[model samples]
Target: MLQLAWGLCLTALLGWDSAVLAAKFRRPAAVFPLPLLCAAALLVYAGALPGFLRAGVWGGVGALGALAVWGALRLGRESVRQLTESSGLMLFLGGAALLWVVLFCLQPMFFQWDEFTAWGLAPKMVVQNGCLYPAQPGNLKASFTYPATSMVTVLFQPFARWSEWGCMAALDTLAMACLAAAAALPNKRRMAGIAVFAAGFVLPYFFADTPAGSYAAQYANAMADLPLFLLFGGSLCLYYALGGQGRAYWLTVLPLMLLTLTKDICFAYGLMAVFLIGLDLWWAGDAPARKRFLPAVAKALPLAVAVVAAFVSWGRYTAAVTPLQETAASVGSEGLSYGAVLLGGVRQLLGIGREEKFAVLMSLMFRAFFTRRVCLLGGGAAAVGCITLAAAAAGCGAETGAARRRVVTAYLGLAFCFAALYLFHLILYYYNFGESEALALKGYDRYLTPYYQAWMLVMLALLGQGAGSRRGAGALCAVSLAVLGIFAGRGVPAAGFWSDASSRYTLRQDVQTKAAALNPALQPDDRVLVISQGDDATRWYYYRYELTGTVADGFSGRYTEVGDTSQREKGDFMNLVSPDNEYLYAGDCTVCTPETLMAYMQETGCDYLLLDRSDGYLQQAFSPYFAGGLQDSMPATLYRFAGCDAAVPFTVAAQESGVAG
Candidate 1:
């Protein structure tokens, strides 16, 4: 039912956008891009409008009415028979891809702390309470930095918690479905466009993964990352399809904004969109081009204003009310040998850095072409068979120069857009880190996961062309398939992502079990303070991050001096600095010894003290207010502090609250 409704709503939205672009720009006879891009959006809109109105979305209904006007206009003038027939193949391919993605790769488990902070926890918080909670029952309290993704998720969460995931999934699926339908059109430009989507974003199935194969598997929300990535791509496609201007501009803005709200990574796409539009405006010539460009400018205007305003407001709020701090050691590139960094860069270019990159690339190639994994021994072969249809492009194409240029222009423009986006991130990392391999997570490949597959697919498609005349598309696909199969069989051994889960979850268990064995050492409501050897020990403090008042970190707050402090003085602190009174310890204070923590805790009236590592807390190193003795640091034990000047102002909460949603 939701699927059917979404299809109509999508249709209405796309149809209206197409009519608006055509009416404003007055494209010659028919614009292929407009129809190709706008078709599915129209269907989804048509399907979704009535129910959305009935649900008391007066504003959404108003938007629906406006889109319907455009839908009616487009339908009145443009013939759907050819367009529907033309898009049929792509629609089918995209739907199949959608099914494969939803069933196979996507999962529901919230694996990312980043996602936990932004989406999973935020909506959970918002639905249960009106305003955001500063912190849960566990540790420190401060401002909320959760991004917009939670707000988007929260929209459906209010009705019913169960409906929340289902709503998001259904809408995201519709977006994917539209993307697939758009790709199935019957022209070289259309096919190339489809190829762009295939290569750039969605991963080809890794056999017997999620929905396609087994149910109990590796992921919890395999559905999320891909949907947002495709939204970014399809939004771009829609922009170009609607001629990138006029009322047709809304086609791009609506999706781009929605994508922006999906996650922090996606906000980068919104920035990218602004850049692309600005570039288009600068490059375009004459009235027709201007017509397409201007509406885009207008459409993007609202977002541009809103985004800037929001940033400014948030920036001001943070600066005046709450400050967000970051570490230069982690963020900056200072001490590494530049020469070695350059060598590391060369290693990556030479396929030498981590096996993971090679493994991912190898896995992608196998998945794109063929899967020989034991999990998908039979019918999955037929899915790869569709690659055979793509070969038809070899024989069927525009024979004329003018026709080829149009097709080439669109792709070249898109390629340039991607190149610019990649270089912008790539150079930033290189400029800072020189050539650090550990810098991969700093937005290199992860931010661009959806688009990576496109590059892989294009390689295959180009290869397919070479083999088209002699071996036939089937053989080309089959051979490609065979290559992927072999790679899939061996890729897992190379992907070692869990190298760090060791000590953390396990040591946390040891800590908990050992502490539990010491029965009545602390009551359920009693506060236990944690002092890591240093900030690095926090990695082994996973249970503490959950925000139960039972455990507290002496250093989610406080000053540090363990490592080099050439850049960060007291002036460098970006956040509030109240001593962590709940727990006081000196585990491994490279710069801050037990002496400093004990006195700080004593002055703050903290009740517990723990010590580790035979190092001085630098009582001589700090003022008495900031120092204490750590001469007895060898015995690592948690002890009670009997003498304190005054108690902390706040009492610990009895129960720990789950994330916002």
Candidate 2:
């Protein structure tokens, strides 16, 4: 209920025009609430709102609700009649809402490694500390370079207080809904729009290669990529709308700003998108089109540029704080020429079958789609592609030479830019690393997702424009529905049909339970150091709340010769276990000694030490100072410092507050 209210409030505050535009078409546009909700959270985090405003985001929610109501009332009788005319659109909206609610209830809290360390840790910290900075210096590996807009927000913060993962999942629902709304924008074909919307929900699962399916894990995790789909895709649609007659140009501002705020790569993406918009404007040729385009760009570019500048400044800040050697680990030192890089990428692409069969198979599926199929899936995709291309060709023939030149220039320019960017990303990966090794990496596939998504939106937009005939729209609607049905059938069983939380898939509940058990003994400001297998679980350690900070794995420690980097002359070392990050340990030396370890601990100011069973060898070495143990089904042990109290009561209420993730 609060989620719905917050969505409504957000819609009022930032997306009133978007809601009105959707109403103008009598379409089910539910996306207006999401970005506005995100914007509200971001404002509070940036300290733009009054201090008193932070107590509950709901106050802003109420005000926004009132504003939305007022806006609706002003729309008058004609608009009301227009909205009520679409009974079919209403049914689609109702069904989507019900399915999303069911999915939200069935999903578990985040258990993904990326979720814990990369993105989730920051929000968890903000919610606990009531501020954004890391409480412990050792906790910075969670990538301080990451943008905070979607990280710590009201949705996940005070409102969904009990479930950290649940907050992430709710945001996912909103983002998915927005993407659907973008696909269903302004055109009158209600069923086609809903099909487009359903495709957004199912496509990610179809693309996911895991046996457990995308929904069982990926979609629910609090990551920026999913939201990127909505913001970037919507920006393109609005860019297209600049050529049309509407007030959409005004609505494009916040989503574009949010896009820049959401991720580092967005800075480059936004710049390129702006460049494309300008190129398209020049080709639009019509003086009136140019007039509309210029003013929209004038209003949007300032905010977009400011966001890009702020993101770059934050990145520079993170770079300055990191050491030279550690910085090398993040990016490559040897630069490859463009020719060599491109050649390497092509060679690697052809040789994909040698490693990662999934990539090869998926590539073939996509290839089959373009060339024009094995079965319904590929055939439907090919048919859709053919229809869009044929329509584009016919439109090209219908235009005068000057108009045709303009259309061709814009399409070719966009195609070239996307290809260049995608190649640049792939080549960097292949050049820095070996062929098969790069293929094995996840970054290659991750980049492809956005690349395909952008193209998919473009194709869908083109198809919508050309399909003025009822027969064409009905064909698209049928193919889209078939695609949706196929994915829904496959995804449900793979996701465990909503029977279990999927918490056990990653074994994170025990981590939460252990943290809860240790919370009462420590103050809100007490710092705890977790000695585990690696830094992957650091965010998991910090998930719910019990400690001021957690010291996990990092890259800045003394370099040692371990693991196989036989290709390189000198291998990099594992970061030694140092609390303060002052001293370096090259595998052996003071680590095994009791006095040296205790002195290091004291220097680091860790109030408590939590040890994973994987670190049993280190636990044996520190057995002389063993204070006590934690209660758990898992192999986790806790020991207090020598001068600390011997006994502490275990509190399970916090752990029990929310039933598993």
lDDT of each: 0.38, 0.48
| Model 1, span 1-661: residue lDDT tens | 3433343344344434433434455431123222333232333222222322113322333454665576556654453333333332334334433433443233233334443333344444433433332322321222334223333333323343423233344344444433542342233334343343343223333322323222322222323455455555555444444444555455455555555544434556666655555545434433365565666465557766644544443334334433344211122345444356455545654666545644444344334324322222322233234223332332234233332333344344445656555544443355454334423324333444454333234333333323323343444444454535533563232211212223224544444443433324444344555443433443224334232224543433234433423422231101212233224422232233334444545544455533322233322332232122334233333445544333331122111121111
**What C-alpha root-mean-square deviation, in Å, does candidate 2 show against the real structure?**
8.4
Give, for candidate 1, the lowest lDDT window spanning 10 residues.
652-661
Best by TM-score: 2
What is candidate 1's CA lDDT for residue 458?
31
TM-scores of the candidates are 0.48, 0.70
Per-model root-mean-square deviation over C-alphas: 12.6, 8.4
Name the weakest run of 10 consecutive residues (lDDT summed) in model 2: 567-576
